[model samples]
Target: MWFKNLVLYRFSQDTDITAELLEEGLSHQPFRPCGKTELSSYGWISPVPGGDTLVHQSGSFLSLSAKKEERILPASVVKDAVNQKVEHIEAEQGRKVFKKEKDQIKDETTLDLLPRAFTRSNITRAYIDTRGGWLIVDASSFRKAEELTSTLRSSLGSLPVVPPALKQSPAATMTQWLEQHAATLPSSMTLGDECELKDLGEDGGTIRCKHHDVLADEIINHLNTGMQVSKLAIHWNEALSCIVGDDFLIRRVKFTDTLQEQSEALNAEDEASRYDADFTLMAGTLGEFLKELITVMGGEEEKEAAGWETKATVTVEEGVEEDAPF
Candidate 1:
């Protein structure tokens, strides 16, 4: 386990103090003139598991499937769940505040008093600990810790100032995150819908969609022989770890989960069918295949967009009924 803590301090004045001149420095406007200083510059993994953790997920998988098939619940229920998620975030982030003070003191022996000291700004301190799991000690005695807090943001780009609503796990690490906190969620998503979005390869940009069940076949027969399905999936997962489903953040999703229904759709060429987990298709040439993938995925438009040439200008929302057409 590793722990990283950051502390930044700001001062009101930059002057040295001596015991004898304490009173004089305090009483005097300018303590002995100090030499001018140069312009100051400011400076700045895991594995599968066993036991209850695994068992609980297995049960959860079945339970969630049953719940999902329970007619999508009422709009009110879905709204309540979303509202609860927001409130939870607000409570965790809450607010950061701090206090500052100064006092006067005189050196009895030297017959001198020290001037009052001032603390201009506040310092923010954060503690991150990872053992069996991970926890963040986000309390700060200083005010205005946003910048310092953001410094902790990884190159991957996930905003971690606030506690992550999604717990960290192997299989569910990311899925858990999207379900609980994704802002612009894809609606009409089925219980088993699974989409893998990615931003990688050539120009460091690429998108591809293949039938979920035919995933093995499609990957094996992709028009481009250079790309590997499993490798693409791994990259997509890594990038999403940092994006964290924010509205301003545009995510490139890759549709990966290939289900039995999805396989059938490609055979029948159903464009709107949904794959098991509602994964979006890669854009362009890949999108056509994505459309077919959707047929079995479920929760797609009846006939897809009339002008649906590619996978742009489209969005899926929460609690929406099955859309897209074959």
Candidate 2:
């Protein structure tokens, strides 16, 4: 499956857990439906639905899925029920219910309606590169990524992974790039038409641009005025493209069709074989891309802190799972 957004994490220490062990550990928290009176439930699920295996592995790459089920109870319905209950209590007591009593009634109403609530489900896909000691999640936002990591930690007992934080800020580096001539950029990098700049002062004003050369005098003047580049879109090596944030998160990734053709040409006889081939190709390409990105951003010092690092990289070129939850 292709990852839309990357939330990279570096392993805190060397982990010796094997695929078999991971599968065993995850089996303990296999996905289950939401229970009565429960607002939500989260657990592990098969990376390939209908497949018996929970952990899908292609070489050193391991893929997994976390499923979350949340009950959909409309707030209006709950409020109406609570109001009715409050009225009944007030009539019984021959007086209006106190604020405390009304709050309790609201809580009770929610609990009563939860079991009958319809459920909405979402699945978050994640992969680990055992050799590279990285965890990559296909979540567009940090909150979603954190949810996936939290579920992983709960299942595995301990997952010491954190987001990458560099000593040299990307914002400052990007600001410098914008203030300079286009010829000064890395040989493999070309600025795209979109960017986000933020003021460095306490007000923290932000500006976003599209379809405009970021190196223009107007943009440079803002940088001269202490506005730092917070996000930038760039084409790398004429093969990969993405919007990279100051925090090192990469989103809206697009790879050339050459990579797609290679994936389609993979002639695996079985589902497992096809999966392996896809992961290998995608990971190899992305791994190289990330290596270059880290080098350009100024290499970060290795640490045991909670942060993420690029492991084996994969892209949408692997083909999307028809059942993927976006």
Candidate 3:
């Protein structure tokens, strides 16, 4: 399956791992449905439904999926049940139910409802680029990406990775790009039809536009009025298009029709073959796009920052890893 969104992370350059090794590590906590009384369950699962393998290898990329099943017991329902029990007890015993009893009743209600409550399940897919030292997740939510990384760390005992940080903040760079009217963008980069602009103040207003020309005078007027571009749609090298946000998260990713047609030319006869063909093409192109993206954003940050650490360059004599090139 193609990834609709991307939340990218960087792994240490020296972090050596193989598909078999990753599969063995993930096997420590395989997916299992939530038990009758359990409220939730989280574990590793095959990216392909009904597949037995935990790690699916396609050339240099390794795909993994995390499954999370949660029981849906609304707080309002629990409160209603607890209130009913509290009222019945007070009415029959002729005594007011205090906070302690009310809390106990609430807990009891939750446990009683847990077994019968409906459940919802979702799968988060991600791929590890061993060659480029990147972990690319197909989730728009940062929280979901962190959850997958957390589970991976728990399973493997340690995972040294951090989000890609750039020397120039995305907001500042995008703001400048908008001010320039897309005339100074890097090679093969072009403005799209959507953008989000917001004032700099803490409580300032935000403006979102879609199907509107970003270089039009109307949008430029907002820039002249001190609003900054927080999110912008851009097409990269004719391969894919996505909206890059100030938070450095890429959303609304779509591979170009030409690229899709190229993958289709493979003429895969089975599901596995088709998946492998598509992924191989997607990962190969995405890797190149990221390198140019990092360059256009003023390259990766050189030092450690508040929320992330840059991979350090180490010498072979020290038996340490080199800094990630991209």
Candidate 4:
């Protein structure tokens, strides 16, 4: 810390000020940083030749005592203190934003603040107080939170007005209608200006979307189908060829819902899983009716099988015998 205490005696290059001890090394003192000092004692040493010899003036040395413990903060503390230490600045920025005032500061270009105090990382959500102290934000500590509460009201409290058409019509879904007809939904809608989509240049379209392009189609299809939820089976080997839609969402659809007791109708060990779902409607009602008909007819019996017992048909007419030659 010798350098910390070491005084810098620069030649005071200002025209308006001059005093003692400012000339520390030359023995002829000059200007000072703090205050004027008495010219306590003076002595003149004359040069041999000149008309008036130069005077070597001296006095009590003016002291400029440094008040700080160190001239500069250590590098690491500087990095952290500016980051977390300033609370007053944070209070100002957050408070003014709540009121509809023109005076407001954004906490941009800085990292999100952390809990430490006075680490001056460029990343900031902070400001400087009148005393030059940094004020930081503590997200976990609700110290100055009355201000944040009202400002946060604009986050989730309001709902967008779905068009009277979307709300009233039972046929069109929220996703489909929004896709084909956003212009009629509302005009310049806003959550206090936070959520409004950015307008592109004159000829271009709006640059934001409520959801991904692909997601809107998928969700619309799910809502339209008979309102039956697709069942997801966790067991893999128990799976049938019944995966639906595409990729992972697909699964076998069967008509029978109850766990059926094993019988000739469902012979294979793999077919046991078909009993897990209801095959009744799936046969002809809903799930893949055309495909199910093909599977039932694929059996070697080829002809239409008898209906579930007791519906035996009476003979329409006895078959006439063809004569054979001996």
TM-score of 1: 0.17
lDDT per residue as tens, model 1, 58-151: 1111000000001112446444544554556567979422221111111121112111211122222222221111112212211223332333
Q: Estimate each model's TM-score.
A: 0.17, 0.87, 0.91, 0.13
Order of models, best lDDT first: 3, 2, 1, 4
Residue 253 Cα positional deviation in candidate 2, in Å, after optimal superposition:
1.8
Question: If both were scored by lDDT, which would come out higher, candidate 1 or candidate 4?
Answer: 1
| Candidate that beats the other on lDDT, 1 or 3, i.e. the better one | 3
Across 1-326, the per-residue lDDT of candidate 4 in tens digits comes to 00000000111111111122222321332112221222121222221112122211112111111111112234465445444434445576664223222112122202222222232211101111112111111121122221222121222232111101111222222223233433332232101100112222365332222224423454335434423222112111121222121011122222222323322256534432332122221211221322232232231221123121222211111111112010
RMSD of each: 26.8, 5.8, 6.8, 40.7
lDDT of 3 at 274: 81
Q: Rank the candidates by TM-score, best first.
A: 3, 2, 1, 4
Top of the candidates by lDDT: 3
Clashes of each: 37, 11, 0, 36
Model 2 — TM-score against the truth?
0.87
Deviation in angstroms for 96 in model 3?
A: 0.9
Cα-based lDDT at residue 14, candidate 1: 23
Which candidate model has the greater TM-score, 2 or 4? 2
Q: What's the CA error at residue 201 for candidate 3, in Å?
A: 1.6
The true-versus-predicted C-alpha distance at residue 234 of model 3, in Å, is 0.6
